[model samples]
Target: MKTRIKKMSDDLLWIFYPTLCAACDRPLLMGEECLCTFCKYYLPRTHFHLQSINPVAKHFWGKVPIQAATSYYYFSKGEKVQRLIHKLKYKDRKDVGMYIGQLMGSDMKDSPFPKPDIVVPVPLHEKKLKLRGYNQSDFIAEGFAKSMNAVFEPQMVYRNKETETQTRKHRFDRYMNMDNVFSINKELAASDKNILLIDDVITTGSTLISCAEALLEIPGTKLSIASIACA
Candidate 1:
């Protein structure tokens, strides 16, 4: 009886303030979420987890030692992926990350991708985190951890320095901007355990490279990387 009432209430509220799809801006039907079914179906999944030497892994070649790397989707400008990401990062829709993470986790269930003992999201600086009121990546990592049955350790890595946005920076300049920016918590470090680093997106991968370098400092730690999308 209570569930019926809640559903009715939601339907009434939706009628007055319709929830639009993040990608297409269409009013979402009942039971649809941040994205409609059509957008979700065609979101450009990379399926990189199925390949060992995929492009994401190759990007880290000679730069950092990662067991493997994959991204759930291919991101492009003015596309559905970008719109979904913009909603998550700039529009306070953290659930978008969780939704995407759960989908990514499900897709990796039978793949050859290495499972990690711990899942950690790339941290945002204190100032940026304060302004944002949340780390969007945390929801992604949290949902992924739940689906993967791994430990979610958001504090395992810390961002000590506030760096400028890499949106307009060149590759080398982005690498320099992210240098010495991340540090790991010694107490949380698990020696000889696999750690999966999560990020929302990978462009030049400079940020992930810096985070991976810090995570590798832990003795006997095997590191891997995953992201919501690759640009």
Candidate 2:
């Protein structure tokens, strides 16, 4: 009886405030959440998790030691993926991140992707966190951790300083800008643990690298990386 009542209430709510798909902005069906069925079908998956040495993994070669690295989707400018990410970051649509991260987590289950002991999201500086009201990556990591059965430690890393956005910076400049920006929480740090670091996107990988470096400071910590998209 309660289920039937809730359904009727939801239907009435939809009539007044329809929940549109995050990707296509289409009215979502009863079973649909965040993305429409067509948009979810068309998301560009990298399938990099199946390969040992994908482009994402190659990006970190000779730079940092990683157990594995993969991105769930290929990100392109001015496309559905970008729009979805924009909604997650700027539009206060955190469900989009969680939805995408859950999809990624489903892919990783019993797959080539290494199981992680802990899952951590890239942190935002206090100023940005306050301004944004939430860290976008936390939602992503939360969904991922749920599916992977890993500990979600959103505060595992702290951003020490605020830096300018990396969107317009050159590759080298991006690296310099992220240098020494992250530090690990010693209380949460543990040795001989496999850690999965999560982020929304991977462009030049400078941000992930800096976060990985801080987490790697703890002894016997093996790091892996995953993101919603890779540009």
Superposed model 2: Cα runs more than 4 Å off:
none
Which lDDT value does model 2 have at 98? Answer: 83
Residue pair clashes in candidate 1: none
For candidate 2, the per-residue lDDT at 134 reads 90
Give the per-residue lDDT digits (tens) of candidate 1, residues 87-113.
999999988888888888888877899
- TM-scores of the models, in the order given: 0.95, 0.96
- In the range 64-106, model 2's lDDT, one tens digit per residue, is 8999999988999998899999999999998988888888888
- Which ten-residue region of model 2 has the weakest summed lDDT? 96-105
Model 2 CA RMSD to the hidden true structure, in angstroms: 1.2
What's the lDDT for candidate 1? Answer: 0.92
Q: For all candidates, what are the clash counts?
A: 0, 0
The residue-level lDDT of candidate 2 at 87 comes to 93
In TM-score terms, which candidate is top? 2
